[model samples]
Target: MKAVVNERYGPPDILDIREIATPEPKAGEILIKVHATTVGRTDACALRAHPFFVRPYTGLLRPKRTVLGLDFAGTVKAVGTDVMKFAQGDRVFGLTPGGYGAHAEYVCLPADGTVSAMPSGKRFHEVVVCEGAWYADTYLKKFNLESGHRILIYGASGAIGTSALQLSKIYGAEVTAVVSTSHLDLARRLGADRVVDYTDEDFTKISESFDFVLDAVGKTSFFRCRPLLKPEGVFAATDLGPWWQNVILAIWSSLTGTGRVVFPTPRSNRSFIEFLSARIELGEFRAVIDRKYPLRDIADAYRYVETEQKAGIVVIEVVPEDVC
Candidate 1:
């Protein structure tokens, strides 16, 4: 097997593809020969161990798990003795949130972990964004979004933003997405009722109000968007603001009962993935991939994602020939 091993927490160059032992399934686990994976903010964050929180569990000075990747779509090559639900040749796609090891030819995960059968019709690049979408879905659900609700989503081009935009539309919310000029059309294509080019206009300066404001990329704060939120509206984010500012905002909102700030705890399970898979099959959701890279160019993929210019997911196509 070949994998991009990460031994330290630093630049994307810290990861390099090398021959490594293929993982074997433990009891209740499945060994998947990954055909496609994604290198995005999740992989980038875990690789660099930013925000200083990933250090405790991953490793203080270095990473405990050398392999780095998150969302994966692959085929099951083998299953552990206790895993009866899946068999060899079954197509699967899900998140390895427990351990970052999806950037490789093969990965082993517990059958019951955020794993599910891959939905048909969609390409690997599209399905590979499911994990991030799952997280985005979870955060929005906390607000119990309903039809006719007016909402604003900032950074509406990344995985979480894209997912949030589509899901919000499905729930009947009138979504106004804020993105750069380059991504204005992308947001509209994803079903945003309205799109704002942040490059040309300052969204915060506008007089329009929304029932909720979600900073999908954690690029803005409550203070900047407070005017946009209805009095009882909520301001939530996928990424925590600098120095725990979002956390402080959440607490402040709780006490004031004015503009509430929400930070939903992400929950990913097999059941969630199963539900999302069904949606993908129905053409209700899709992932916009900006680029594709072979396993050998994984470092470059990471660099590209770090640029924050990607419109959606950055897929890493892992054919067995190139990996093995």
Candidate 2:
């Protein structure tokens, strides 16, 4: 099996595709012939070892998990003896969380982990995009967004941002999406009620207040965006920006019970993927793909995602499967 191996933590150039031995399923695991996967900011961050704190988890010196990918959709070629929840030949779409081996043509995940049946009638490539939406869906669920709520999503054109914008609309929230000038239309198309160009205007300078503020890119802190939030509104981030300040603030808010800073960490699983798949199957959700690259060009895909301009998910086609 050929896989993109992260030999060390540095530039995308350090990643290499090599003919590695295929993995076999352990007890209570399933071996998948991965057909499709995605490259996003998470992959880039893990690769670059940004924020520095991740080093202990990813690697102290070098990457512990050499293969770099999180989202994958593929067919089950084999299952371990103790696995009863899934069988061979079941098509699935799932996430690795921090396992980080989805870039390969084959991967082994616990049978009861994030693995789930792929939504019927969806293509491999298209269904794989749902894996990128896991975090957004998790956060929205935590916030319990509902009708009449308003959310200001900064960096609304990226993977998590795109998913957050659409989910906000699905929950009937009035969404204000902030993005670069090039992504204004894309933000609107994703169901943002309004769009702001970050380069031209400061999002925090606006008069409008939101029921919640989500800094999807982690570029800004709760202190920076708090003024834009309603008196009791929530502020959240996907990334732990700048010296773990957000993490610190989130802790303080939890302790004081007087603030609304939250960083949600929902476990990804079969049920979670099924929820996202149900939305896609109903045409209520769709993956906003920015570009597609062949398995051989995965480094380039990482290069593109690292540029920080992608409007949605950047996919890597591993098995040439058509997706919807």
Candidate 3:
């Protein structure tokens, strides 16, 4: 099997595609011939070990796992002993949250982990979307977002941002998406009740207030968005803000019982994958893909995503759709 290997953390240039031995499923696991995957913010962060704090979990001296991809969409090649939920040739899409080896042509995941069957009528490349939606779900879960409640999503054009905007609508929240001028129409098309062009005008100056103000791209801070929140409204961010203020504020908020600032840590689990699968099968949710690259050109894909300008998921087709 060929895989994207990054022995040490650095830039996209550090990545190399090398032939590696295929993995076999362990007890209660499934071996997948990965057909498609993605390069997103999480992959970028893990690749570079950004923020300097994730080192302990990823690796203090070096990357714990060289194959760095979180999302995988493929077909089951084999199942381990006692695995009954999946069979050979079953199309699937899910996250490799624990070991982070989805970049390979073949990878193994626990049968009861984040893995799930592909939504009906969806292609392998189309469903390599769990990473973004999984992170977006953290906010919706934290806020306990409800129908009729209003929510605002900042940086509404990126993978996490796009998914957050769409999921908020599915959860019955009236959503206001804040994006640059170029993504205005994209935001509105994703079901944002209102779209704010941050380049043309200041989103903070808008007259609307929200039950939840989420920084999906980690480019904004809570203090800057505080005024837009209702008295009891919550402010959440996907990243630790500048100087790690979001984490600090989250602890303070939790200790003081203010419930003001929250730092959501994305969890990968089968329950969430199932949740997304249902919505996708119902045709109420979809992943926003910006572009795709062949497995051989994944280094270019990483370069593109690191530019920080991609509007949505950057897909890597490990196995061409025609072949799949």
Pick the TM-score winner.
3
Q: After superposition, which runs of candidate 2 have C-alpha atoms over 4 Å from their true positions?
A: 322-324
lDDT of 1 by residue, 195-273 (tens): 9999999999887898889998888998899899887788898777888988887778678865488877876667878
Of the pair 2 and 3, which is ahead by lDDT? Answer: 3
Cα lDDT for residue 240, candidate 1: 76
Q: In candidate 2, where is summed lDDT lowest over 10 consecutive residues?
A: 125-134
- TM per prediction: 0.94, 0.92, 0.98
For candidate 2, lDDT tens digit of each residue in 222-258?
A: 8889899889899999888778887888899999996
Off by over 4 Å in 1: 255-259, 320-324
Which lDDT tens digits does candidate 3 get at residues 201-240? 8899899889999998888899899999999999999888
lDDT against the true structure, each candidate: 0.85, 0.85, 0.90
Candidate 1's error at 39, in angstroms?
0.8
Residue 80 displacement in candidate 1 (angstroms): 1.0
Residue range with the least summed lDDT across 10 consecutive positions in model 1:
315-324
lDDT comparison, 1 vs 3, better candidate: 3
Cα error, residue 96 of model 1, in Å, equals 0.9
